[model samples]
Target: MKKDYYEVLGVGRSATKDEIKKAYRKLAVQFHPDKNPDNKDAEEHFKEVNEAYEALSNDDKRRRYDQFGHAGVGSSAASGSGGQYGGASDFSDIFSAVNDMFGGGRSRAGGGAPFGFEEFFGGGGGARKGRASAGIQGTDLKIRLKLTLEEIAKGVDKTLKIKKQVACKECNGSGSKSGATESCKTCNGTGEVRQAQKTMFGQFVNIAACPTCGGEGRIIKDRCTSCYGEGIKLGEVTVKVTVPAGVQDGNYLTLRGQGNTGPRGGAAGDLIVVLEEIPHDLFSRNGDDVVYTLAVSFPDLVLGTKVDVPTLDGAVKLTIPPSTQPETMLRIPGYGIGHLRGSSRGDQYVKVNVYVPKDLSHQDKELLKELKKSQGISPDAHNDPHAKSFFEKARDIFS
Candidate 1:
């Protein structure tokens, strides 16, 4: 037997069109599939709510509903329509009306309007179809890729073993039991459902996906033994991705159609790989330039000298200008990372560290004593007003 349209919306036959609309809005929000997520009960309820609202919200249909009851009004039950519309009416109508009220782009958490969010923005019109482009896309998956400094500089290829969610071979995403499919009992095969409640705010109704059938508008009487009727399985697969040189950390690479398989054989979503770079112990990168530190003798700082320093290319001799200050920095151009798009390489910088011997030989002590006396300087010269100690001077030297 058909339930009364007013009863479907939990309203009296005398309810005003505004009352019908309000009731439908409440039910649609509560039962939306995105809200219910994977829960079968929520999905089914979601469908029922939409179906009921479809019948009672339109003036013509609502009038017909008042005159002939549920049978005379004809089944619409979705949030918008007259008797002229049916199961194939644009699925987004109810959603669009809700969107106008919500005042925001579609919510990532599934819009508050179960019907309004996904159904509204995902795409729709007043038609159902067999169009080639029509179908659900798979859910995208993410993986973090770690790159070494050298590998990033040179660019590298990596083969990864990743598991993606694919539709079950057993039921093909039908969530069915065996080969037997049945109409959704909760939604009555309309794929939508509605209900009303009295809250502090007022009397309201909610719509949601049909729980009994998970919004497919049909039920699986028997479960697929392999998938237990859920219709998706976890499988492992290997894929190789090429990491381009100069790939920045936190950047993502997308492999199209490499994500989870869509339900009902829809197009596959993309796989997103996030790149992360590992820090190097021997080298520090400053933009394209590399930085290195080499120790030198005090005499080298005063007299100046060429010292061998390690670079990405190899050990190169770095010349310090005469009377070069301790911790002076020198640039060796074209010794750093290569330009991502150009032929040029970045420059490398070398900082000189001047050190005093910890242990003095008899000859060294004599030489230093004579040298200090000749220069009118004492062993405590570092303690003078103008000088700082070796440890404290590193900052000044480097600075």
Candidate 2:
């Protein structure tokens, strides 16, 4: 059974066109596919909303529906009036309603009214000729660059060899050995072709690049022998890149006009370098901070000792204070990674791990027994804070 159109939009039959449009806008926005993705109920409700609007929004349709119900509106309710109601019509109408709500102006290049969904979701196809051009832009390229912690701490320069399209040297990007050409007859030098297509919405004109001259608007009379009339060839080029300090993994550096050259004499694109961090053996990165674990003998921890600690710059002497805890962390300022585009440097954190002897010799055991007696050591000494345990403190490092 068909539900009442007035009930669907939650408006009276006496509602004006502006009221109908306003009600439909609210319901359409609430159930739009972009807002309620993967929801079947919202999709169906959205269809119902559009169908109700299509009928009530039109005076003739609304009069026929009011007088004789679905039968009076004709086969529109059954075949969905070729997208006048629901299903595929739902998707297109949803975008139409959205465009109206946002006050979007339709494209005037085509003779027929614009299908909002086709223009909104589907990227501009060959239909719109006003924005068409003869010169094609080159495609952008991406490359992965692996950097070490040291390189990230200190900005480094790298030379990259890339394979890209370069303008042919033989004809100087003209694609002709004799530099002779004639205007294309197929597109009439417009560099595009327009074709008319009939749809449910009416006649629509589609524009595409000219097939004969490949959108160049001219035909090559004499082909270049080196590039075979392509006007471009694959070649290797070296690019010098300066990676900034403290750049994290997955960050990108863009080099404009450094990618493949366009066909003929078109403009070149960009080359993007994505950064990847390589792990270090002794140090791990935490934001701008460097984390390193330093192992010291039990005697060194009790009596205090000076040891060399590894840093982003170099190894430096770090003092372990007397009676220091096994899990104690020491911070050295201005010894870690440098700030990107800034003058400040980060600090390095060193964690201490005390080492205990696993085996004891006879003389060592005799001295330990005398010391234990003098110190009044008990069997439960393992529970002491200074005693070695299997538990280890975990550190979270970004790298």
Best by lDDT: 2
The segments of candidate 1 whose C-alpha lies over 4 angstroms from its true place after superposition are 1-101, 104-138, 167-190, 196-205, 218-222, 262-269, 338-344, 373-399
- For model 2 the local lDDT of residue 269 reads 79
Give lDDT tens digits, candidate 1, residues 1-399. Answer: 545556667888778878878987887677665566556676555556566676666677767766777666553443334322222222344444455654533342243443543343332221222334312456899999998877766678999999987777777665554556777788887554555544332333445555554455666667777766656677887888998766677978999988886654456779999999898777788877778777788777778887788877778988877777766778998887766677677788887788878998999999987888764333565566555565577787898
Query: How high is the lDDT of residue 166 in model 1?
Result: 74
lDDT of predicted model 1: 0.66
**Residue 18 error, candidate 1, Å:** 26
Model 2, span 267-289: residue lDDT tens = 67799999999999999889999
